[model samples]
Target: MKRRDLVIAALIVGGLVLASAVAVARLAGDPVGLLTRDAAASAGLPPYTGVISTFTVMVWFAAGTLSAFIAWTDGKHRRRLAPFAYLLLALAADDALLLHESVGPRLGIHELLIYAVYGLGALRIAYLMLGEERIVALAFWTGAALLAISVLVDVAFLGAYLLEDGAKLLGVLVWSTVPLLAHSAPRAAVPVLGLDRALEHRSQPG
Candidate 1:
């Protein structure tokens, strides 16, 4: 990475640590808790209990990172991939924090409302992918379909935790393939300004 990129990354990490300390202090009056214990220990639960959720969060984060990398490196496709980067990152944060299920409820924001917002975000992504390669778009659509089904099962099947979570996990896995597919697909030729003029000059019996 460039020195500037490294510096920016360091600043971001530092800011995150500072913000987290402040938040912890405000909420629990003990910033030490943020550093001293793992989440499972703090919750009095076995570490394995959160394994699946942790995996899901990791996948979401990985997808976001991949999308961001593509956006940064491929100027031609940056506009299309940038939104995916942001949305995937937001999803990762929401999942990691249980924002929709727990925090949103406490804040009087209905879980359904949060789901609707996410649904619209997914639709926006689908629309953006309309001009992409068919295979890549198809994978994303399949992932979205699986996620929709997971949401449906969550609302209707109530107690079918295994099925709902399984579908959701599969959806995330499929969705995460989009960045990889995009990165591997042949890039279109980028137009170079004045190239034609230069070629014409060279061709003119020089």
Candidate 2:
């Protein structure tokens, strides 16, 4: 990954966070009484009683977009395809989120797939980052722990979807990892043109 790639990753994660904030806000400010009940039908759990204002939605959505971007772009460090694929997968869920308010359970499958991919991608990134010996510090350890916890949180959502409606709100926990992932390891530089090694090294910048 190049420095520019890292910057882009940060931007993507920021976008996810932003998106999530917007989602929660809309749920709260459902002008026409869309959210008749604060409780999630699948999870059987109540929604947050706190005011879900547009400002909250804006902030959460931005963060969600940012995190979703990071999870989607999972392989920028080595294999670009991995990240690109994940981003596309996340989009399915993002779109599902847009219509879930009116669709009523029809889009749960899409949302579920998104959460699964997001969790797995997050786990992969944490594995890579934690492999670095230098990441044994307090901050790094905290981040890694959070990533691990996110996997469980995602799993909880899966369980809720499959069994009860009590845990549908689990996504918030996993998406929170976006900010942590934004602080990434130093990326490898994209070497300039070097004809001598062009044929020998495929990854070398042409």
Candidate 3:
């Protein structure tokens, strides 16, 4: 395997191990819980909230890395994709910086504005993807829908931090898979399981 693949594997494995450890800590109510509680106290948030936020950061980092790799490899040939790459980077930055949660409130801006910016970015990416890879387009739409639901959950409810974060992570995972899926199938650029492919195969000669 390539060095990049090795690094990615390590990151995934490490993240899994860390998540397991956190789970164990929650069950045991020992040092891990104590540490997490202390950290939460310092941060003035719930313990699980800190844990969820940490995992969310990991997801964002992984997404950003994948996006950067896609931009580096594919953007060389398709210059228009450079903007998509930058969009992913901006997403990572927004998550890392908590731009909406932090800066938005300070500037008298609502989270809706942040969502609008993200919506515009997604729309631009969809426009760029027009007539290109249909699977990627579907992935983008699916991710957008998932993220929209996450935003709604956050806005409409209270004390659902874990649920909100889980939804956001799921959405990010969907988005992260798009570039990988597009690269995985060179001929069709999608998993060979959809009705479109089924119709095409059905129409083929025996």
Candidate 2 CA-lDDT value: 0.43
The Cα local distance difference test for each model comes to 0.81, 0.43, 0.69
Model 3 C-alpha lDDT per residue in residues 1-112, reported as the tens digit of each score: 6879979999999998678778878788766655344566766876675676666667766765776676677732143245655766677777766888888889999888
- Choose the strongest candidate by lDDT: 1
> Lowest lDDT 10-mer window, candidate 1?
189-198
Residue pairs in clash, model 1: none
Q: What is the overall TM-score of model 1 with all chains considered together?
A: 0.81
The local lDDT score (0 to 100) that residue 9 gets in candidate 3 is 99
Error of 3 at 137 (Å): 1.9
After TM-score superposition, the amount by which residue 136's alpha carbon in candidate 1 deviates from its true location, in angstroms, is 0.6
Q: How well does each candidate superpose onto the true structure, as a TM-score?
A: 0.81, 0.31, 0.62
Clashing residue pairs in all predictions, respectively, total 0, 36, 0
- Candidates sorted on lDDT, descending: 1, 3, 2
Candidate 2 per-residue lDDT, tens place, 72-186, comes to 6543433322342344334334433543323434745564554566557755544433323243222333543543454455456554332221122233333344334433645
